[model samples]
Target: MEQRLLAAQALGENELLDLASQRAKAVENWLLEKGHVSKERLFVLAPKVEAATEPGKDGMKARFALK
Candidate 1:
């Protein structure tokens, strides 16, 4: 996830969104395959992940009340 975000930082806004979406889907699929998380749960959380990684938004720092 950190790697994905770092790569996204070097990209344009649209590309960042695309990268985030792709990474989220990849992670979701991996988790599903590994039985770490259920498909229903992944579906619910995937949007949130993409939103958090999204550029020009509030970001995870604000969401989590970070400094």
Candidate 2:
């Protein structure tokens, strides 16, 4: 019947999608194991640099504080 054929097609599609997802996850895990993919922090805030001006006609000086 047409209904049975449609059901079989949907099941096949779902199986293919699941297999593709699993393959993708395997590749990702392999990359991580090989260190080709980095999971480190992508966004890091750098220490703020402040500019101070001496009480003279000289130019401003840059200063940084280390914790």
Candidate 3:
């Protein structure tokens, strides 16, 4: 969370969001590659939580909080 905030400060809110998105994708890919996390448990998948579940669009759920 701190990293995202720092990135937002460094790169602006939109860029920071993109950065978080990229990071999430990277982590998801890595987990999939390593077989540590199942596709069903992945946050980016459909029928999953959207990244914007909270009132603020800045929340991480904006990407995976929507189902």
For candidate 1, write residues 1-67 as lDDT tens digits.
9768876765445655555566666666777898577666645232222345566655342111101
Pick the lDDT winner: 3
At residue 53, give the lDDT of candidate 3.
Answer: 53
Query: Cα RMSD (Å) between model 2 and the true structure?
Result: 24.7
The TM-score values for the models, in the order shown, are 0.46, 0.39, 0.47
Candidate scoring better on lDDT of 1 and 3: 3
- State residue 5's C-alpha deviation in candidate 1, in Å: 18
Scanning candidate 3 in windows of ten residues, the lowest lDDT window is: 58-67
Measured by TM-score, the strongest candidate is 3
Clash total of candidate 3: 14
TM-score of 1: 0.46
Which lDDT tens digits does candidate 3 get at residues 1-67? 9878856765444654566567677777888888677787766642223344556445443242211
Candidates' C-alpha lDDT:
0.51, 0.43, 0.56
Candidate 1 wrong stretches, greater than 4 Å: 1-10, 44-67
